[model samples]
Target: MTQFNEDWKSDRIGSALRGENPLVITEMSSGFAVMGDTQFLPGYCVFLPKKTVESLEALPMPERTAYLSDASLVGEAVLRATGAKRINYSIYGNTDAFLHTHIFPRYHSEPPERISRPVWDYPAEHWKSNDDSYKEEQHGLLRDKIATALTQLMEEAYLEKDV
Candidate 1:
């Protein structure tokens, strides 16, 4: 086992920056795109800033804009990769408190009750269930797809800046 897999949760952003986080899908201009731990919602991902900060409001305006823009870019990539009906973006610093965004893909096939509710509204077991945990054999393809989409989007954005 790798040091990161065993203790990455202790410092997600730090490990991601070191390229030690196996969950990392790609590194964005402003952050890193990481696959969520559970697959309760397939294609679920998170955007983490380059450095640690308690909340988004703590960042300067330019950094804040980049973080937020990166979040939406991750959302769009999740949507395109997962083919979800829509994407839900969230930023609650309650747990990790590292100024990150959660990108969830909402699908039309979800139960009627769950389709409209917040991802947190789902039972807690959903977050910890091994059945829903990310497995390379099962989710690696999806992760690759999301990474590819995000990389392309970023390239396009950079090209636009040059033009």
Candidate 2:
């Protein structure tokens, strides 16, 4: 797997969290959620946080609460955008200690990342090159969409509830 240095960290991440996808709706402090990069399954978005905080428990109380709130917001956005029957949420910090989450929209027949066995293993491919301009562009466009959606959601939430 390719390792990222501080420089990589300095560069913008989660630009995808922003856009006008049929899925993906917001970028939370703990992470952002957007439609999955691979179209094999639609409305598959990755929720990656802004900071590298490892375990969720490690976050300060206020941040922890806010993070969950954001995660839920993303979930609602995904549902609103995709009309999925259910949303699957997972947090796997194994790939990078930089805390992140996955917000997957599950249809009845989507294949499990893991099988009957609790232990799930699959082939991995590390990004071999930095020529991800397409990803960058996609991220930019998505970021705009998500931000707009989030703003609307926030207004509704704030008006309807005390939040």
What would the TM-score be for candidate 2 when compared with the true structure?
0.59
TM-scores vs. true structure, each candidate: 0.96, 0.59
lDDT of each: 0.90, 0.54
Tens-place lDDT digits, model 1, residues 1-163 = 2334458788999989988888999888889999999998999999999999999999999999988988898999999999999999999999786788999999999999999899999999999999999888899899989989999999988788799
The candidate 2 region of ten consecutive residues with least summed lDDT is: 117-126
Give the clash total for candidate 2.
Answer: 13
| Candidate 2 accuracy as lDDT | 0.54
**Candidate 1 versus the native: TM-score?**
0.96
lDDT of 2 by residue, 36-146 (tens): 444333455666556557778878988887777777777666666566667777877785665666676556554465332221232222123233221434454544554
Model 2 spans with C-alpha error above 4 angstroms: 1-31, 109-150, 160-163
